[model samples]
Target chain A: ALAAPALAQANPEVRWRFQSSFPRNLDVLFGTAERIASRVAALTDNRFRISVFPAGEIVPGLQVLDAVQAGTIEAGHTASYWYIGKEPGFAFFTCMPFGLNTRQLTAWLRHGGGNQLGDQLFADYSIQAFPAGDTGAQMGGWFRNEIRSQQDVQGLKFRISGLAGQVFQRMGAAPTLIAPADIYPALERGTIDATEFTGPHDDERLGFFRVARFYYAPGWFEPAARLHMMTNKRAYDALPDAYKAAIQVACAEADSEMTSRYDHLNPIALRRLVAAGAQLRFFPREMMQAAWTANEALMADLAGQNPRFRALWDSYRPYRNELFQWFRVSENSYDNFAFPAAAAAAR
Target chain B: ALAAPALAQANPEVRWRFQSSFPRNLDVLFGTAERIASRVAALTDNRFRISVFPAGEIVPGLQVLDAVQAGTIEAGHTASYWYIGKEPGFAFFTCMPFGLNTRQLTAWLRHGGGNQLGDQLFADYSIQAFPAGDTGAQMGGWFRNEIRSQQDVQGLKFRISGLAGQVFQRMGAAPTLIAPADIYPALERGTIDATEFTGPHDDERLGFFRVARFYYAPGWFEPAARLHMMTNKRAYDALPDAYKAAIQVACAEADSEMTSRYDHLNPIALRRLVAAGAQLRFFPREMMQAAWTANEALMADLAGQNPRFRALWDSYRPYRNELFQWFRVSENSYDNFAFPAAAAAAR
Candidate 1:
């Protein structure tokens, strides 16, 4: 421990502030940012320290991109989809309805030309984004009533985000965007009939099951949502290579750590939720099919309307198509057979 | 760059050698060790440097564990299952027939008590183990003939490894463990009728498609094969906290990098294999079912006979069973719906 302070004294100490889009209450999500900071500090022997601020502490949650872009903060931890209003292409970096799952998304981002394309996109906003965390496939929002078919969605108000919200709207549901903090009150007061937020672990913390008994399966809207650490481009460029490497490595660990935490915690939370009277049900096949149809149409329309979206879709669509083929043959086959057998044996 | 040399002068220089249980030609697999070394060097300002030696350079591939444990090499990169003959519990740290996939295995190892359990087991050998890389779900072996049923596997000479070999033998196949370099020659000369290696990228590199043209789907055996970096306990404990942190971070990056690289490259290799006349086929449902049955029986017998195996199995099985339920609801549902649609649209 004495070695750390000595090393810090030998080097000029660097400090940066990180603003997280999530509140501290969602520790698992927000903790990813803290993990990155602490890891960097530890790796650099305390010469580099990053202070993390939760949502509204520095800038409002949704203004993370704005703050980062304007260099008001050195960095921000937030989902890329939150900035879809600035550019629809932003959604691909986070997730899309019926898009790639976590593993697939990571592969695409790191290897399948996504990182470069993402950098090119973010360069427009004077930010450099690094994948920091993932919320493995979210659940379909908690529902106040059983949704048996596409008709059940008619005139229903659902809180969702990104293109999935558009798909829901196209299917006759009134899709609303609400902050994470407001979701519980909205669902309770019937201000929104249902809400989808992250997965079982985060959702349980929000007490969604208490208000809506029917916990749905398969969040088709945002399959695998990725969180990013956005650094001000000028600030990032000025850092020494070692500092840059520290940030990169820390972000990679944070990415894996958050996903693993979710995978471990979500099951425990789901089991507890069930024991406490939450009914787990699959979104009806009819509804799923309808959403898929709407998603395809919406994607086609977006591609037609936005060149940036088209450029990204052209690359991503084929890569995803190829990935799906491989995954279906590999992951899906194994899971489809093994999971059911394991479930049966447990029963 | 001047800062790097100055930093090095301020710290004691450390150099270590890493022995890899993989050939240099198989860069994707072997490169993980090199990646760790370079990343550590970059992070440590060259105060610490690790030289990587490929299989046969320092010790034979299978002798990696022995060399690391005996302190003949400071560190090693190899698959844990390669040492199952030393203790069958070692197989849990790698992969089993129908074991956890990459993400699930990672979750189990990192967050679900696997790291601690692995350390306890490795401590007995005076080695410290860190997961360094993963080959995401491998493909079923390249076959000389289509396996239409369980009968098709009967008496067939199959090149496989780990517990899967035992399972195959129980299923009436003559399972042989052939070195990766010899697999292609064995398949070509009719010495072995089938061979399962890492995945498409490695298989294509080994030119399995040239001889066996019937490339199979879904490697039920060794779904997610993990590569480990093992260090002598004393050597690891003697390192400063900063150096230890550097190794851990480098290993984490390597783990994610290897998996992402495989995911990116496998699809490309599979497409090329198909174009070059490799017929892609799924292992028959009957055969998969038989393998599952054999796997269960083998696990039971091993648990009954070995206490360590039982202890690890007791922790892993329940975790896996629960993981299956959650994945079935989340990942599988999305893939089942999205994949076929994507494939059809592509066609």
Candidate 2:
């Protein structure tokens, strides 16, 4: 314990328990929690150790943030978007519908002062937060029936999480909050007409394609989803500087790992889902328009009610609008010509 | 499916089934497979889609190459190092003990003609391969007890995956093969005295710190572990040009996503781990030397036996040596002084 004495003299090791909102099945989210724990331990040399519990182990998955704030758990891994039920502004810390992609989200957090704003927001909840993982641009939820027009979305019962639900609900869909585990059964039993569970790999694993054959394209609701690691503010401030650095390094690493994993697995899983007789469908023009309008209205209401929401909306909306126009001009134009033609020639 | 008809006219929709040698639990590896499928689908519209299966669903986790070769699956995602058990030379394709980090491996593969060499070697197995994911440099392994001298490692049963197992075997440590799910239990039961799984995030999730208090540093065996996406040569070559292009683009995207994700998630995970009671332990001087020497011997054996391994060894060894010296002059020295004191102050 030669180094122990030195570590002890500098800072005392603190033991903590971290609860995760997602199950171990979603590696990016669950793995983020695991990654933070390891880095903190390494940096602090065992003086500080954190035990991680999967969603159901400590508290109900959805209640992780509340548990952390209440100090029932010292820390938590979840999406800031999940807390929108408590405050609509919380979604900005995670991501927004039809908003930034992974790169832009990171840029906003790291360079555009999003991190500072996020820290400030969490401070009110007695928590310290960091951007831990992003699921890039996600796909639209899977559907049991093909959505051919705006009318098709009316009265649709969909299982969607976070702020996306509010937007969908405004479009006249019954947006139900279903856990990832419960999604499969709900979709299977006709409890949900559509559901979104990340990209193809996860959707396929949960057998969404088995019961629901109509898979949709473009996850307009969750353009980029950011997962977070939140610690008790007091606990985080007590971390040794070395441990904090390690946590930073580890979170950065998690960002990379999560993106790469999604990039690789989503393709193969999509292919299988399609091959297994699941029909891939796209939202009609009218449907997309309606949803976007609904999303905007919901955001406006959220901002009107909360100052933090207003602050983030001021920055986020303009950035997204600018990005949307740019992507439409270049990426959309080039991809349309190159891909569809290429697909035809391949056949 | 309005877009599908146009896409079909340009390039026919092709479907592929990919089996992964990883569970979605290991996000980076499995996620790469997911990204490839999604990117290909987006590029080709609905014309090209690939479905993915986890390691155990179609076959055992480690037999990704066999499945690809047999054409039971069109493609697979796995670490090339996992196949060292089949051919000692395969380790260089994935990584070598004390070998290249992320940058060096990327340089070797993309610019240094390592990919060409990899293709030539995989040709014998009737496979086409691409670099899918990289876990940069890794931590050594979690040890149950502190390592004092070379003798401390002798006769120890260590659960290690990939080519590092060979190097440890040479050092008189009995290297055991344990699946990711099984690592914690193996370590807890004292069936293995040490184990390594990526960096902190993953190691922390497996709860290695709970049982093994002594966490070691510097993952010499896997400085950069690169995963590969392999396809049966015939299956790949038979694809239409457009499908081929889609696959290539998809692979490239997966490559980027895997690394980016790692960068994001690792930080917060580390801090949480530290607060959990895990102790960080560095390897003693003598043990490191023994392992390094053993690695050299293993490398020499592979070079002598496999021509492709020899080619890679010729190119990689020198590059690694040069990089090490460079890092020593820059990164290593700066980090050593900066980290410890900074860590102390933060504490």
Q: Model 1: what TM-score for its first chain?
A: 0.96
Q: CA lDDT of A157 in candidate 2?
A: 94
> Candidate 2 regions off by >4 Å?
A1-7, A324-347, B1-347
Pairs that collide, model 1: none
- The DockQ value obtained for model 2 is 0.01
> Candidate 1: lDDT of A59?
96
Q: Write down the TM-score of every candidate.
A: 0.96, 0.51
Those runs of model 1 whose alpha carbons end farther than 4 Å from true positions after fitting are A1-10, B1-10
Write the residue-wise lDDT of candidate 2 on A149-232 in tens digits.
888878999888778888888888888887788888888889778888777767777788788888776776666788888888
Could you say which candidate leads in TM-score?
Answer: 1
